[model samples]
Target: MRIVHLADLHLGFRAYHRLTDRGINRREADVFAAFREALDRTAALQPDAVLVAGDVFHVPRPSNYALVQSQAELLRFRQKCAAPVVMIAGNHESVRSADNRCILELLTAVPGVQVVTENPEAVTLANGQVRVVGLPHNSLSRLNTIDLRPDPQVPYNVLMLHGTVDSSRINDYGGYDVPADLLELPWDYVACGHYHTYTHLGRHAYYAGAIERTSNNIWQEATEAKGFVLFDLVSHQAHFQTLHKPRPTLDLPTVDAFGKDVAALNQELAANVAAADITDKLVRQKILNLPKSQQARLDARQIRQWQTQAVHYLLDARPPTATLSEAIAPDIAASQGLTATVAEYLRQRELPKDLDRLHFVERGLAYLAQTEES
Candidate 1:
């Protein structure tokens, strides 16, 4: 039987400040468009079943527009494909309080769709030929307390879960974790979510990855193809299909500004920006080893003009270290801005081999930027 595996849709995810012609957030519109494309392709493939592991929405409390648009798309999928679509809730759609309802529960009203908001539930599909055991995102207490083993009654079982398997690689964004031993469970296939990059854990287990760029690490994930997997249960094999072309992102090489006058620094920055095609792409330019005096003298108006030409531009500037005499005093070192210090500290730490340190630091810096703005 052919089964399509997809996860981390993040339908309502928003970024930058650009707005579409319809007055909706540009990023939100991009995400919604990507989902529509995926659904369109799924209908064409005519799979027996479509499995959506988790993170259906960016947040548990999505806007009414997001809800209405998603419902329309899902109903269209049901009408066009006539196939069962099984979905589970991820951390983004999980609610902490019992009184608070998970927005995913709204999807239960849609025909040909099954929404699993709680863990340890099994749903049979294809006239009992396939048994899918779902484990949705849950609190740590619930994760530890639940029974995660596969059902012995079914030989063709698929384990669907949204959590971290390798504890060593935990994301700052919250997610429940299961021991790596869980991957060893007796199942025909294991579909995982919560990680935004496609990965093959074993012959059968896989992460389909997000449909579009949904995080600050867009530059890093840009290198990886963004798409879904078509898993053939009969043959125990999977094939990835790219859903959409990702938005272009350019991370320019760092420029050292030591000893360069304001005119020289401006010339270098202007030349680098001119060399790259940043017209409609997300771009980042960093100037390092600059002194405070040089930064003050830099032409702010020209930088603003450069930013206007691109869809989104980030200009990061780092100041040079103090002189030996100034370094002798602890106060001078501590005087650096909190955001700058945080970046420096993260740069010094030894991160895990699998983790991209540049992305990690970039995310941290993004958060810091948001905090400062708020």
Candidate 2:
């Protein structure tokens, strides 16, 4: 028996403000397309069963377009593919109990697709010779309370779940500290999700990761090697097959901008952008430790223009420092600072002479204004 393991599809996600032209989010379409391609590939491979660990949608309540796209893809899998797909809800989809009802209930009507959310359930596929024990997101709190342990009598058992593995890397997103002993169970394979990187816990435990570069944050590891894993039940060996979806990311040549002027910084930035190879990449550009004074000189329009022309993402990789804080203008930093500088600025001093004092006074007085005007 063969199974295609995929997880964290995150369909309907929208991102890259510049790349999205149809007034629709680019990430949404990319995500949907990824699943479509994966399904197509799965059909070609002719797997016996498909395992989607969790997080099929980026949000609990996906947009209508996303909903439609997801339905279409699943329908295609049911009608076209030879394999049956088993899926579950992850943290994103399990935000509310009501949210899971729409997708999970809809999937039940489909012949080849099976979805589990809210509680754990064991689905035994007699024809395929696979017994799947699935645990959805948010069920970890009640894991000890529940009595859903696998039957020792079952020979080939697979545990499908979505959560943060209990380890040093648990502090990251969507990660929880599940007892490490959970993997020590009698299950043959533990397929997990929520983390965007393909990883393994010991030997039997694995994460298939997200289908595509859903977020700019994950671009670093989003190399050529992106996609699902294929597990051969008879051989009991798993192979990570690389998906063809390409995301653009850029690495700007490092430059020390401690005392550089705006002109120098702009020159270097322009050169870096020009030199970057971003044909199919998402254009995640990183410039580290840029002088705050130089950054202050950048106009918002210019920044937007640079981002449009150069990359999908424009980021400052500078480490936060006291000198950097002092170098930047108080007004600029006030709006962009990590702390609430905008409120502090108003409390400290009166409005500047060039600035309209009336507007400031009106805003300040409006807070205390309660009476109706005649």
Candidate 3:
């Protein structure tokens, strides 16, 4: 009896908005293709059972197209692999309000799939003589007292779930705290999910991790080898099989604008981007410590056009400085132009692009003015 353990597929996840030549988000396409290949390999391996821990979608209410694509992929897994699948809802899909139901539960109606999202449920495969206990991401209070202990007499038992372990680390998605001792149940193997990175918490307890890198923020955390785990019941050990994914990444050299001259900085920037070797891959450039003078030198029209170019990601780090308007703020007499100046300052810096960006810019301008006066 063999099993395939996978987690955090995160279908419908999109980042950095560079579309493919076909006008589709390349990142989203890569993720979908990764899962398709995983299922194809699982079919070839002929696993007896398959386990998907959680965070199947990046959001709770994913677009209908995403849901349709997901269902189509699951159908392929069932038909081609001929293995029963056990999946649970992670925090992203777990509804906090009682008035709402979980999307994972809807899959129960789909043939050949078992979804456990409400309560702790135990199922036994009479033919295979295997028992599986499933626990979902729910109120810690609910699972704390629930007796999850499996029958020691059973020949084979596995625990499948999506939640944090008892370690002091917080969940990267939602900060919900999970106690590690939850694995106290008597089972042969405890397969977990939630964290996007693959790791082992304890003996027989493991996180399969996400199938592919989700975003630029998470790219640094991704392992060079990507894919799902093959759990061989006969050997009673899980082995990770590397899956090949073709995506490009670029690392930009950091520039110390505060200390470097304009001529030297531009030469360095040109050489860095030119040497990046991103001709055939997805491109993301990071520019650090850009000076006001450098910003003034850049062609604004060209820069704005580059935003929609093949380059999928960009990060600009610029030190706050006094613009011409701020140098003579008293004479300006609180004109509306002040707001536009502030907005342009924040926008060109490539900040987080959230409300925090506005807050940071406001606070930074105040600090810079005070420091300059003193």
Candidate 4:
């Protein structure tokens, strides 16, 4: 059986400050465009099944635009491809309150689309050719209770989970770690998610990366390609289907300004900007060991002009006189953002049964991000 595996679509995910002409967030628009292309590509392949690992939405409650576009695009895929799609909920869309239901369950409204949001389900397709076990985010958190054995009756068993496998693609914080021993299970294939970079964990397991760049530290994933995985379980082949280029995100090489005066530093800056093609791209240039006087004397007008050439320009000039804490503060915060910290806190805290933790934490993080910008 052939299947197109996709994960971390992150629809409604927005970054930076740019907006589309229609007042929709530019990054959010980019994500939708990539998703459309992915659907188009999947339709062309005409796979027997489409498996979405997780993080279908950036948050538990996605925007109206995201919900509408996703429904339209997915329904189109079902109409054209005539295949069944199995989607599961990741941590992003998982609600902590037992009273409230997961938003991903609503995706089942579209025919031929099966959503496994809460419990574990074995979805048999192609009249018993394949058995896909949908292990959602919360279920993986309590792995011991689940019966992970493959269905003996099916020819192919594809295990799907929205959690981090034992790989470098694993994030430093707020990740659901699936043990290495678990991957050694005798399954035909394991389709994993939550790691935004495509990776081959073993002979049978693979991660289909995110469709678009959704992180503030876009440079961290500069080398990793964004796409989905097309695996033919019969032939034992997993091919990565790369999507069209989304918005460009570049992290220019750092400049050492140990002894250079203001004139020399500005000259280097001008040359650096001239050498790079940053037009309409998110660009960042760091000037390290910058002298206090040289940084102060740097021409603001020249920098402003450079900013005009790109979607956003970051002039990261750090002085040597700064304290240790001051130097690493931003890095610390970026490595574990307000959202991630809240996630970690929730995991450790003993919360009230009536509290809606997902809404409370996500709202607080949004407010904190806005305040930081202000």
- TM-scores for all candidates? 0.81, 0.78, 0.76, 0.82
**How displaced is residue 174 in candidate 4, in Å?**
2.1
Clashing pairs in model 1, backbone N/Cα/C closer than 3 A = none
Superposed Cα RMSD, model 1: 10.3
Using TM-score as the measure, which candidate wins? Answer: 4
Give the clashing residue pairs of candidate 2, or none: 164-175, 164-176, 248-281, 248-282, 248-283
- List, in order, the clash count of every candidate structure: 0, 5, 2, 0
Error (Å) of candidate 3 at residue 333 is 43
lDDT of 2: 0.70
Ranking of models by TM-score: 4, 1, 2, 3
Q: Is candidate 2 or candidate 4 better by TM-score?
A: 4
List, residue by residue over 39-158, the lDDT tens digit for candidate 1: 999999999999999999999999998999999999988889988999999999888887888899898789988988865688999998899988888733476676777667765799
Model 2 residue 180 CA deviation in Å: 1.1
Q: Model 3: runs farther than 4 Å from truth?
A: 21-23, 126-128, 139-141, 166-171, 184-186, 280-283, 299-311, 318-374
Cα-lDDT of candidate 1: 0.81
- Model 2 ranges off by over 4 Å: 19-22, 97-102, 126-128, 170-175, 222-224, 298-306, 317-374
What is the Cα-based lDDT of residue 145 in candidate 3? Answer: 73
lDDT of 4 at 173: 41
Task: Report how far residue 239 has shifted in candidate 1, in Å.
Answer: 1.3
